[model samples]
Target: MNKPDVSYSIFQDWRANRGNIKAQFILSLFRLATWVRSNKILIILFIWYLPFYRFFVEWVMGIELPWSLKAGRGLKLQHGQALVVHGQTIIGSNCGLKHSTTIGIRMNPDGSVGRAPIIGNNVDIGAHVCIIGAIEIGDNVAIGAGSIVVKSIPPNCVVVGNPARVVKVNEPVTSSYS
Candidate 1:
């Protein structure tokens, strides 16, 4: 929602509730990258990720996270592997992204690049989930694993299956963090 609180320290959040080893590693790298972006004086620190960035993206983490992806505060990576999010994607606060999840873009009929998905606050995306196109996943939505989401989803719903149909609605919004 309202800019999703970017004041908190990502390093502290990772130290407080490090979900898994892979999550810790990825978050650490992401935090370092974010910090480097803010303070240009510390640009030398980016050299640490340059060599391993491709390896982590393709082999280890299996993610395609770019510096342009706008993520809110309290972002959590559950298993932290195979998560592909486009550069134009906007992820909300306290969102949990599991392994093998993809939030990518598609091409428009005019042969131009389409918009990526916009995920709202407190959204829990499960493993092996694919969210494509310019869909808007609303706040508090929980998508089950292996679901392929091609359409926009409303808030406070639980979606599952190949086409990601809403199985339940009006559920409580819960976060993985304490």
Candidate 2:
């Protein structure tokens, strides 16, 4: 199934944190715009989402997304469509959530639900990554394309493949950084 688009509170949460730099926010906004512009197909689908995102929040889901959702300074969503963020998910600053990423919890044995994910800052989640359960992803971790992340990942690691093995380390993105 396609991931749903992000709602207005995503940006609102980022903006509310005054400690987050303005330059980083501008850069993130720029990144989002440029990435969407380059991908016309994604833009078309997301265009429709903007209205719903701007108009509806209460009528959509029951979970109340806490302020910031633990999302830090610069949150960049590249073609984020059909993405589901459960209330338990905790993200960090300068994170990248690509298209179709679902950040939620797993089903219990009795068909209830487990704990939410605790993601660190400066992380990059690739498209179609399903991160479930009570995993604590470290800072600057990059989840690879089409990965299913169930376990906790250490900081600065690049995770890939089914169940996602650490393929590389996240060397800080120094250049062109705000």
Candidate 3:
């Protein structure tokens, strides 16, 4: 797998969540919180500020995106409510997430915690979607709403329904997002 970009610019991500006040506020707050955690001197300040951050991001915004999450650039969160992404999940660049989506891990039968999904670039996921387990979502994929994705998906496909069977494959990649 290719290495993820180490450089993180809040402005670039802000541009993606632009025109949406909720998305802008939530993402900016997350970025700032992460930045503070990354700095040794600022971590001291974060110790006192962590509670407020959790309250606002979890209770107010209704988003459970951890500051430690490795999300890529241009992550557009549409109707950013009830969205929960696991900290271990790696989301690629130019991905769109709608409301009521859960991208997390599935528990093992032995009652152990499992790994989260690694989503690829330019993937658009709709509302009421649950993408669970240690699956890999390929780039340029579009997932319909109310879908439950468990298995790994290939690149450039359109998947939907309860089990998320691939309905279309090798679809053309779109450049712009609305």
Q: What's the TM-score of each model vs. the native?
A: 0.80, 0.60, 0.89
For residue 121, give model 2's deviation from the true position in Å.
0.5
**Mind sharing the TM-score for model 3?**
0.89
Summing lDDT over every window of 10 consecutive residues in candidate 3, give the lowest-scoring window.
1-10
Please give the RMSD to the true structure for each candidate, in Å. 4.7, 12.2, 4.4
Instruction: Give the higher-lDDT candidate: 1 or 3.
Output: 3
What residue runs in model 1 are displaced by over 4 Å at the alpha carbon?
Answer: 1-7, 12-19, 38-52, 57-60, 171-178
lDDT of 2 by residue, 134-160 (tens): 889998888988999999999978899
Ranking of all predicted structures according to TM-score, beginning with the best and ending with the worst: 3, 1, 2
Scored against the true structure, residue 104 in model 3 reaches a CA lDDT of: 95
- The local distance difference test score of model 3 is 0.87
lDDT for each residue of candidate 3 in 81-146, tens digit (9 for 90 to 100): 999999899999999999999999999999999999999999999999999999999999999999
> Following a full C-alpha superposition, what root-mean-square deviation does model 1 have from the true structure?
4.7
Worst 10 residues of 1 by lDDT: 1-10
Model 1, position 153, has a per-residue lDDT of 98
